[model samples]
Target: MKNESQIFGIRAVIEAINSGKTIDKLFIQKGLTGELSKELMDLLKKGNISFSYVPIEKLNRLTRKNHQGVVAHIAPIAFHNLENLTLKVIESGETPLFLILDQLSDVRNFGAIIRTAECTGVHGIIIQKKGGAPVSADTVKTSAGAIFKIPICKVDHIKDAMFYLQASGIQIVAATEKASCPIYDIDLTPPTAIVMGSEGKGISNSVLKITDHMAKLPMYGEIASLNVSVACGVFLYESIRQRL
Candidate 1:
């Protein structure tokens, strides 16, 4: 049971890393030991590649082939460099519209947001390297191939990206239910970056502190919150509407 995006076996994973392949995620069986495993660990540390220790059963579930206690998911697409993409967008003379996902974990919701972002004319999407959805085959399918159409960047820290965007004159607008103002009241005509949070936690307090504005979608029904993907569409379209 080999997934096209997955590479198993310690030697194979090490070779992939040595060949400069971007690893989306890596799983090593707990207590895994051997000379090759040692070499893999050393390479991972040297490259700062993140991996998790999991039970042998988990490795087995990932692939039926002999994993040698290691399995790695190759990033389906090459991620863009945030700084370079931002500078390029600014230089192109288009009012930049960027989407920043703060630890968004659901794969389907992530896919849907990517699709919406592509439709709404987002310049680029920025996601944290960890604690976010992987751009797997499912994401490619769910996005209906829009994943390739849009530029996506993986950053070490979401807040750092926010600071860079702000310095680039892009206002950060965070979508959260806790905001005092409705999204419609915010002016989005300028260069903008919309920040959407995780499914469970709307937006972290640390992230909220630095945003230029925080806005909430008007909710009429008893349900207080909307799904992240749906909410993201409303927010992005609002920006589009204001720009138009």
Candidate 2:
């Protein structure tokens, strides 16, 4: 995936977002007192774009330009729509394997999961646009370039993506410590979509309610949980095992 093209001017960024370009993340200089800046902010608020308010130093580091106190990093990967990607997978003569990240924020974890997903032959990955890590330099580095080869779909909401997957005959499985069934027990050979949550919290109740199965990794150790990325690898490999 190509790195997102940077647009520094406030109006240029606002126009790009308005024109339906996927902005990876926006950096707005803190404490701007200009009418154009205020107008740009209003557009961001209306569009519900995710952005960080940072000091001018950060903006300068991004570019030596007078950035007008604004810069939006375009998405490195051209994100496909969830429904379209799901349909393409169904038509591709293979079982659809999807990894859905629920509010997972760590860049390393995100990248590691992408690596595992790509190696395991997951057809696509679905992530909520807001809570997941944006494709940054560190994510690309951590993924070891796997991010470039995988198809990542950014959705408006997790629940909506789940509905689309289910409608397309994809089983939604939640991998968490709270599941009654062990991951090894679930039949992952079918067309399946596995949902992994953030490190701090497991899958949200709103999403868990809609899952077709809830499976947990069996543990026999003092520490009750595993790192989110490691847990993801276990679930993904289990699916590969079942498929074999």
Candidate 3:
């Protein structure tokens, strides 16, 4: 049997799409041309799924078996609907607490945040489609199965999700070192979604510009930064403390 984590070959990938598999991303051979490749490309565009064409060597590196110019990475768990999830949280008389991960590419950090979000009763976790880490086996293991317990939404853009959440009366707060106010000082008990950026570049400028509040964690040591997951844990636990 083929690996559940990867769908290789053109026909197999097309079948997976038709069968409603949760495909995280597709990598195709650059300049690949044929009726089959054209059909796959058309299907991808129709579904609004993203794909990238790379050199054949890249595809070969990902899989030794015959990939037939395409390889699709499958999401570990099915994604949840953000609109339905947000509405449900509000209707149930629970303040919606969402965790928005912006372009985070580290599997371990992503998993750690999922584990923390589940423990803190976060309504759901949102990840951008393009740059976020795929929910693969390593992520599932690092999360200790918390990835299965929590609701996760994969959106095309984090900014679009931010706008929707804002319109629904959810305050968008970002955790960045540049903010003057400490994370503990933010009013996190309200319907809120905490946006944590990647460790490398921090939050994107576009998303940061629209936030309702910007807060930072205290730094005492010579090191001015914390691991993304560790920072996320601190922010989450503080919110939990305030809500109690």
TM agreement with the true structure for every prediction? 0.93, 0.83, 0.96
How many clashes does each candidate structure show, in the order listed?
A: 0, 0, 0
Give a tens-digit lDDT track for model 2, residues 1-244.
2344677988898788778887887888889878888888788888777788899998888887768999888876778778888888898889999999999998888888899899999888888877677777777878899999999988889999999888889999999888998997899888999999998988998999999999998899999999999999999998998888
How much is 99 displaced in model 1, in angstroms? 0.5
What is the Å distance of residue 127 in model 3 from its true position?
0.6
lDDT of 3 at 220: 96
Superposed on all Cα atoms, model 2 deviates from the true structure by an RMSD in Å of 3.9
lDDT top scorer: 1
Q: Model 3, poorest ten-residue lDDT window?
A: 1-10
Estimate every model's Cα lDDT from 0 to 1: 0.93, 0.87, 0.92
Give the higher-lDDT candidate: 1 or 2.
1
Per-residue lDDT value at 77 in model 3: 87
Model 2: weakest 10-residue lDDT segment is 1-10
Q: Of models 1 and 3, which has the larger lDDT? A: 1
List, residue by residue over 1-244, the lDDT tens digit for candidate 3: 3456988999999999999988987899988899998999999999888887889998888889999999989887899989999999999999889999999989999999999999999999999878788898889989999999999998988999999999999999999987999987799989999999997999988999999999999899999899999999999999999999
Please give the TM-score that candidate 2 achieves against the real structure: 0.83
